[model samples]
Target: MNDEVAQQVVPRTRYHALFVVAILTGSFLLFLVQPMVARMALPRLGGAPAVWNSAMLVYQALLLGGYAYAHWLGRVPVRMQAGIHLAVLAVAAMWLPIGLTAMELPADAEPAFWVPWLFGASIGPLFFAISAQAPLLQRWYSVASGGRDPYALYAASNVGSFGGLIAYPLLVEPGLALRGQSLLWTIGYALVFLLVAGCATLLPRRVGGEPHVAHHSPAPGAGRVLHWVLLAFVPSGLMLATTTFLTTDIVAMPMLWVLPLGLYLLSFSFAFREGEALPAALTRIAPVLLLMFGSVLIAGDQQLAYVNALIGLLLLFLVAVALHSCMYRLRPAPDRLTGFYLAMSVGGALGGVFSGLIAPIVFDWTYEYPLLILAAGMLMPQAFLFDPIARLWRGSAQLLRIKTLAATLAIAVPLYLGLFNPGGLLGPMHEQVAFVGIAAIGLFSVGRRIPYLVALAGGLFLFGGYRAIETSLSGDRTRSYFGVYTVTDMPRERRLAHGTTLHGIQLKGARSRLPTTYYVPGSGVGQAMLAAPQLYGPAARIGVVGLGTGTLACYARPGQHWRFYEIDPAMVDLSRDSGKFSFLRQCAPQAEIIVGDARLRLAQTLPASLDLLALDAFSSDAVPMHLMTTEAFTTYARVLAPDGLLLVHISNRFLALSPVVAAAAARGGWHAARLVYTPSAPEKRDEAAISDWIALSRDPATLARLTGGQWQPLTPQRSFTPWTDDYASVVPVMRALNPSLADD
Candidate 1:
């Protein structure tokens, strides 16, 4: 009897281990492919972060379809299901060594619709095949192990997902080019297939074609399924929203995208694991964290950005784990595991659509972030921290109503103070007083859902949401596919901002025509523009890649032919057509404006048609990675005259980009010089901001003209790799991530 028991235990353990390995490999590849394919498509798609968000939507949709297919397969016999899935895997292998399709982007293609079509066509089959493996394999495990619990396997699955996500940015991206990365992923995929095949062999064979293992538990009702979905929905949407809020409004740090997603995936590991201590504790504290940190997030304090970013990530992780734990507790029998995952997938897809696709179009600011926080409050499990607080809430219906009304009244005071006395006219102490009042009220309201929600909403409003609402109501903000743009009227200047990065500033009245900000007369681009007529004559054909307030248009001579390549049409409207700034209208009214991605548009221009070109395109503070690659420089070389000058604006708060430009110059056999211009005390008074720019040219003499006073020869860093369309990683360039490289 002991030997029989021991033999059964040994095979069961081996089978469990096989399924774990299979699920892990499949999930790792599933996430690894996401960033790889997006990187490959950068040259064709342009480098707006929105492009990444759109790609995430496609991934979510495919994941939904994959889960649905897995659920449907459960109706068939277990052994037959395995055969069908293996065949599906074989068919998907046809798309191995994945890459973007050969379809050309049409000139008038809309990114919202076009991006999905391109990515969907490129990796749809492979992603679908890999995505189905986790749920499918877990179901197989239940049957093969004689109905042992399979939910623990889900924890292992998410652990693999988190590994893949972190590895792409840290390991795979820095070490390999696109071709090598694709090959590596292909090898991984082949390994996945073998692992899956091994797991399938352990399944019991029945000649009668018996139905899948049955659970005695009843099927979940419609309401229960919807409850599972809502619990899943808020976290998925909040993940995207938190990412956007951190990078755009808080700080545009490289690899910041990984944190929210990594934590989100890690939360699943903790939520579904067998141990209850960690997730239970996190859920118990989540509501308090949401109330406190959610308010701080909306406060918009730039001075404390890094600290705030950390707090925001903590808030997102806690909320996600807490909500996901609720779903785990309500999980059905192993027989219904695939169905549960299908419903969760549907919620995830819907959440992605709302946050990634719909919210940007509907709200000028990041309203979805706060709104999702409110949704999380409604869904996350809550309990009193102490017994007395619970008794007060559980006493009577009349008492509950009175306490709720009192909480609402207490919250109203801070809201009114924030809205009316935004400048703290009530006193320097007013803001602190309001903060304490709201915190106290919010703490008392805990354990009661209605009162707690009221407190959370009040905190959101009182901190910084009122200001966002004010900006939106004033019609000064506009949101597009790229991002939000705001026009702020300052005392002496009118400024256009993309997120926290100032794009352009036009001084009032007589100075409106002068190039201010980074285009001040002493800047490198300024020196190049001032000397254009002397070098190329008055008929100099100049092309500018970015048209911020059309500031460079002021450098156009009477007979000089000028053109501006701008990606966002809304920028053209704000700078030229809206009469917001007169730089284009007053200086170069007839300058040609070409609206499209700078790289694609420049590729279409006649070779050697321009005497000089300036590359100044930016999405918020981030320069598009594609625009800085070696292949992009080849396009720039093709478009400019043999001796024509190229000016690149390298001024950025978070990245040390001079090395990248220097390396590109070295690889392409071009002479390069960099100028670091710090505005004089007088220039600062006149709105001349400090700027860094690099000038490169094929002819040494052309670059020599600008190398004397402020310009110095650009030295290539031995440690830095020149970016190419096939390979680039921002990890080494980020100032916060690489403190040793900050001074570079």
Candidate 2:
């Protein structure tokens, strides 16, 4: 029987091209919808940092569902599987253009619950239908082509996924608005459907009196399956960690999310390709790369956003390739391919859940990042880079000495401070000399796991992890859905920081009543506050969105009604802690504080109630994409008095959002002007950094009165159109990096 089937088996050339095209197109459509739909949903759900994380969890869950369905389908005849999958695609198409449905989140809705529900309901069916094609098509190709190597095409599928991710940010998003991008995706889905049909045609037809082809390979054992899952989990979890660390702890550019994901997708191409050596070479050195980059990053400050981003992206790529190569090495035979992919998808989903959802709730810091890095070190295929190191590890006596030395060095945290302190005997270059010694000691333990881990620990501690440890010990840090906040006490003042940006700095007892940071008396918000009494009467009602240590609350006067819409409860707690920031307690103790997503909470508030509404809720460098939407602007207009000024803080390192706010203001038929505040020097303004605030009002006179000296008409580019909820793009607003604004 085996011999007869062997003779009848067809050459791979029969169906390879059709299967490749189907898989590539489906994979491309699968990844493209992720950023697109999230971008579309931004206005409805304020762009809290966790919005994307929640979206990723939804995508992974749907992907696991699709793969499981495909694995179950493998029990049926090839022709039947193809027909059923085609039917699934046809049904999913009813959700064309992949736009979100009109769903309003209540002011009290928990984003952790609402985000997944919204995304799952909007694009769940379509994403699932497409996500199944990669593994399902490969299974079909295996049987249709008579047991050829279909696994290599998995590499091709990932190549297409990487292309789609790259194209969306650099090519697709920059040129096309949300509407056009959706339309283009719909067209691509149609093409992919047609391609799936073409692949079906290549399947051998079922004939009467013929048994269905049963091509079963050796089933993998439980241990081997578990190994496959572990390999897939590390890289998947690390990708999410790298993304969160970059956008949350560093800069929150929408496009930067794709870079890690794209590199992750590309790692599959490197791993699964036949006879490839670049991946193997990278696997050999990936641990060292992780050690170097991870250590530097943990010790590294926020001053080098660009440099840190570059290092972070490269580290993610290398780790992904090395770990994915392990998966490629352990992949099952063609007949067992569906189960293999199912396990891999399960691992990926669990990883996403762990880092994206569980980590925030479970820990006060991004501890998952370090734990995942250590797991990568344990799981990735390692080899002796140098013969001497290999010989040392192979010999027990020498290995013990090496381990002892690593242990000794790992605990020597103060040795670095004591000898290499910049102010100590070694001078300014001592820090560099210390890191070099640490790196050299780390290099000696290349192949041995215990010693290598010791080195990783020593380097990580010496560099970045120390600050986190200090913050943790101090009990001044709090992690929430929005991000992490750290409160530090300086001799002159108490400072609250949300990620790298200072949320507020309150001077010690005597000066605690004064606003600091972006709210200093000379800044844009400061100018608005200084004019509040003259612009509105003493009875004016003031509303502030983003209660960052309640610094703006200090602007309150007697008889003025004030309220704050703060998204994170942690922020509200810290602001009112009095022990941390006294701006609210000292100035406006009775101020009403609403805890929920700002826009949703604002919508619930009475309309046209406030004399002025300040949109100062920024998570570090991120301008909540949702808050800047045209619908959000309309919401602000409805809530503000006819002559009220809508103040938007637009100071950013990456995006020139003055244009975005100006454009939205124009679309709302409001007059807009901007105030650019540069403190000149740190000492001159009591640590108040530069800030650019745009003022919008329906009344021309209100805007005119606010413009002069520091205030000027915001110049909106002629071709720029305001971003509405249904259609908004940030690509054009991305500012060119200049020397002065390098670290903004």
Candidate 3:
């Protein structure tokens, strides 16, 4: 009997190991392909960030589908379940040697809708099959192992997810081109299939111990199922919300989005790993950190963009660990794993709706981020000791429902008056008021529901509401597809901005392609435009893509033909019609401004007619990924005459765009040179100053002519790497620049 028990344990142990390996490999492949395929399509689709958001939505939806399918499969017998999944795997393989289909992007179509649909159709089936493996296979492992604690495999699953995400930007993308990435992924898929087949051979012949019987059903009751859904939803949605808030010029960078997601996935591993305690102490303090960090992280006016981002991510993970641990404590038995995961999928999808879809339309800003943070604070477990009043009240049965509403009201009065009510006695001391409010709320929330509400209110007021009200009342904000552009009206006519590389200022109203702020009368763009009459004649064919208050329109001359390719209609209206600035109507009233994506509009214009094409659309944080690629430059080259100039506004807060410009220029066989425009203090009129501009041209004469006497000959930095469609790394580029030089 002892020998038989040992033999039985051996096969089960080996099969458990195999199951872990298979799910991990599958998850790794699943996440790896997301960024890989997206990077491959950058050149083709024109790197609009909306493309990325759309792609992510497709992924979330498909993930939900996969979970739903897994839950449904639990009704079948063991052999039937294994056979059906195997058949599904074989059928999905038809998309093998997988790559995007030959169907090209429509020249005039919007990428926001099309990119998701196209990519979804191409890889949806394959991804769905692989995604389903985690939940379904884990359940099978449980049955095969005779009710063993197999849930630890979930942590292994997320480890693969983190590995896949980290490896792509670090190893896979930098190492392989698009074609190579696709082929490698296909190979990984094949290996997963074979491994899964191997594991399938180990699945028990019976539901429990009866050979050839059907799978066992879950325990009766809806309350049990509801717990699974809530546990899954909060973490999934919060993960995405963190991505949106952090990645936007808030802490804007390409790979920065991965950090929040990577950490979120890793939390699952920590919570689910076998023998791990999910640490009582860490979870105990998670709410305190979430409240403290979550409040100040959102509210302060300090330019600690990177630091704020770090705090935000840490708070998210800590809160996630706490919430996930709670779920782990309440996790149903192994037979209900698939159902549990399905509930999680439903929550994940709802989170996407809140952050990606509903938030954009509902809030004028990304308020959803802070709203979700408050939600997390509410839903996440609080320590009984931390809520000492509650603990005390619970100790006395009579006080359970009626403890301390009077004390709460008295404390809340001073807090609300001091923090939220503007111009209260504590008016001059805002930060002090906010700090007091946070502390008061934290203590008050101890024994009752009212305290949680107070904490949430205090959090919102301290973190977001205060700043938003100030920004709104100031009337110094701009919203474009790229990001929010705010030009604050400051003392001495100097405007401070938070997003975008360049801020063009005209004396409230000025005209003549003359420059202001970054493009001062003495700057390179100013000098180039001033010389347009001599360089390309009064009939100069000029083109400007980003029309920021139409400041460049002031540089235009009579009879000079000018064209503007603007994507956002809101910006066009603000620049041309809004009384805020009159640069366009005064100097270039007759200039044609086309609305749509600049690249698409540029493609429609007559070739070789433009004398100078100034790619100066740095209005906000987003770097319209479509505008600075080899293909984009080639299109510009085609539109300009032989010696025509291409002046790119390469100035960026979060990115060093010179390399991308240089790479595109190189690919197009054009000579490019950068002009680092640093305005002297004496030149600083009451305008937003500091800007960097780079000029690229195919003709030596145009390059020479633009740089002639106005700016120094720029030596092309050899350290700069060329950005390609399939692979573009920004870490080196960002590291070379300083973040503090902006005219704040």
Per-model lDDT: 0.87, 0.79, 0.72
Best by TM-score: 1
Cα shift from native, residue 494, model 2 (Å): 1.2
Clashing pairs in 1: none
- The reply for model 3, stretches above 4 Å from the true place, is 1-12, 209-227, 386-391, 394-404, 420-427, 467-481, 485-506, 509-514, 577-580, 618-626, 685-688, 709-721, 736-744
Q: State the lDDT of candidate 2 residue by residue for 1-744, as single tens digits.
A: 255545544566767777888888889888788888888876677666567777877898899999999988877877788889999999999988779888877766666798899998899999999999989999778666766678888888998898888877778876787889989999999999999998888776642223333544578899999888888888889898888788767666756777888889988988888886888888888988987777777544678877888888888888889888888888887777889999999888888888888988887777778778888887877677788776765647876787667555663654366244845765666555566666666677667676667667666666657768778888999888677788888888887776666677888867778777787888877877778888998988899988888888889999899999987778888888635777788899999998767887788778889988899877777667778888899999999989998889988767777767877877788888888888766444556777888888899998787678878887666777777766666677666633432432
- Per-residue lDDT of candidate 1, residues 576-675 (tens digit): 8888878988999999999888887888889999989999986667668899999999999999999999999988878889889989999998899989
lDDT of 3: 0.72
Query: Candidate 1 versus the native: TM-score?
Result: 0.95
Using TM-score as the yardstick, the better of models 1 and 2 is 1
Using all chains and alpha carbons, the TM-scores for the candidates as numbered come to: 0.95, 0.92, 0.90
Error of 1 at 506 (Å): 1.2
lDDT comparing candidate 1 with the true structure: 0.87
Q: Which ten residues in a row have the lowest lDDT in candidate 2?
A: 206-215
